[model samples]
Each structure stands twice: as C-alpha cells, then as structure tokens.
Target: MHLQVRIDIQRRRQFIQIATFGVLLIVHQHHTGQADPDDHRLRVFYPRRPKAHRITEHMDRHLIVVSDVIEPEVEHVLSAGLSAFNDQMTGINDRQSLAVTVRNPDTHQVLGGITGRTSLGLLFLDLFYLPESLRGSGLGSRLLNAYEEEGRRRGCRSAVLYTLSFQAPQFYEKHGWQRFGEVPCDPPGTSRVFMSKAL
Candidate 1:
C-alpha cells in the first residue's frame, strides 16, 4: 500500500513537470518571436506541487539519453506513464485506436493508411501515408473520411493533425480542415502546419 502511494505521487509530480514544461515552452516561443520584450506578456502556469524540487529529484534518478533510432520500449514507457496521468487528471481514459488501412487485395499485405487515436473527445491524426501510385485516385480522401467517421462513432467531437507545408495541406483544407498554426522546420522555407476540424 505504501509503495502504491509513492508511485501515485511520483506520477502526479511527473505530470506537473510535463505540463509546466509545455507552458514554459509556449511562453518562451511567443516571447522569442517578438521583436520587443514587452510585445508579449509571459504567462506561467504554476502548479501547487514543488515543481523545481520534484523535477530535480526525478531527473537525478533517471538517465536521459538522446538517440536517432526508434525505441519501442522507451515509447511504451512514456506512453504508459502519460496515459496514467491523463486518466487521473480527466477521469476519462477512453483512448481508442483509429486507423484506415490499405492492403494488397491479393496478398493481404498492409501497404499504407492513416493512424490515429481518439481520447477525451479529441481525435489525433498521428500519421498518414499512401503509395505514390495511389495518389489522386480518391482513395486518400476516402481513407481520411472513414477515419474521421470512426472518430465520430467513438465520441470524438474534434480532430487535430499536423502536416508538412509541401504535403497535403490543400487537400485537408478542401476537406474542411483549417490551419491553426505553422512552425517553420527543416529543409528551409518548409513548415509543419497544425490543423483541426470540428466533428
């Protein structure tokens, strides 16, 4: 029982740390983009928890590593931790996998499709891909529509996604998705466009 309590407390601290970091990054980004310091006001979300102390203590016990390759084990750990915290915070632990796959009719091999999830009344589109030969054949739109329809069936009220500037922004716009923000990224003049739609 004592160990469980300790684990719960640690998860809460980690949640607070992650939330605070996001708030700080937004504030810093806004401030940095402005030509004058006073042009934008810096707002902070101060959690009741001892954020500095808790973060320091937590960081001291953990090993931080940077890598270029995909690590499924690391992803699982982070996802599990965040899911627990989200469940505790909102009291809604409904995270359903949403996907629309394109498979070879002959071999039943999955080629490309859309992958996403719906949680807390929101649908998140994480990735979407289709072969070059399949583009402009109306299959992409069909797959996207199917994904969104399933999200609605799963009780999601809104959907969010990010696409590269050179990618399918116009396609999404034509299908009722609106741009909310854009952040410049690599390859020069390219950016990641964040979009959303009300289901």
Candidate 2:
C-alpha cells in the first residue's frame, strides 16, 4: 500500500512539472518574437477590375509600350514554339511580361526597352531601358511603381530582385527596398547584389 501511494505521488509531481514547463515555453515564445506558426500568417485579397486595362504597346518614333504573352507570335519570331525550348532560350522569362520600347514605331527600330515579370505572389523587375532622349523624364520611377502596385494586387506581401554592381542598386534602394544578400557573380566573379522589398 505504501509503495502504491508513493508511485501515485511521483506521477502527480511529474505531471505538474510538465504543465509548468509548457506554460513557461508559451510565455517565453510570446515575450520573444515567436508566435504560433498558424497565427503568424495573414491573407489578403485584391479586388479585380471588371476590365483591367490591357497594357498595350505604344508605337512612337521615340518610345513604345508593350506586353508580351508567350504565345504563337512570340514563339514564331524566336523560331521556337512556346514550350521548354522557348522558355529556356528567351532572354526574359516571366509569366506576365511587360515592356516599354523606345524606337521608331513605323520601322520597329528598337533603340531601348524595359521588362517586368509577375507571378504567384511575386514580382520581379527584370530589365529597364531608355533611349538617350527619355532617360531623365522619370520613366524608371513610373515603371517601378507600376510593378509594386501590380504585385500588391497579386497578393504578394513582398517583392524580390537582384542587380549587378554596374546596375541599379542605388536606384532600388531609393525606391524603398533594402539589400538582403548578394552574390559577387557566377563561378566566383560575377559581382551581383540581391535586394527585396515588403509591400
């Protein structure tokens, strides 16, 4: 009888200890920055326009704006169908691609161009360009803003991208992103900087 009584007391003591440890763990997590994983995520939805303005290409001698879907026409021009081959070979790989071209609209003389990509919860600013005539007129700013807005609409909480040292790191910094990491090039010599922004 005494042995059974002692065993019961020991079990009760262990239960109390476990309960106290669980409470302390929860309190410590709350005091720190950790929350329950299930409680930490938020979902947001963006209302869509019944008719979103289709981004179209403007054909001016000095400038043009266009959006390209990887389809028959783009595939034909690249001489590769819209399959694995085209995706691998195209200079720009984006699900939704948009661009502004500075060129002779009639001749389609491409002088300079810009490109952007948007996909599931992410937006990438892949490329930008301007002819000598259009560099200082704030086109780059407009493009960046457009991409951010689009990213928000796509339910993205953040946008990420990279730039080379010779590229526009300072420009992205000015637009409200911070550098998170960098790779100084491929095979030990490419010198690239990575950055990201929260929307």
Error of 1 at 194 (Å): 0.4
Off by over 4 Å in 2: 1-95, 100-113, 186-190
What C-alpha lDDT, on a 0 to 100 scale, does residue 163 get in candidate 1? 97
TM-scores of all candidate predictions against the true structure: 0.66, 0.44
lDDT values for all models: 0.74, 0.57
Q: What would the per-residue lDDT of candidate 2 be over residues 105-170, giving only the tens digit for each residue?
A: 799788766567665457776776666586668876776787688777766778888888776788
| Cα-based RMSD of candidate 1 | 16.5
Instruction: Tell me which residue pairs clash in candidate 1.
Output: none
Count of backbone collisions within predicted model 2: 5
Q: For residues 36-81, could you state the per-residue lDDT of candidate 1 as single tens digits?
A: 4333222333322232232222353463333455579878998999
Name the candidate that leads on lDDT: 1
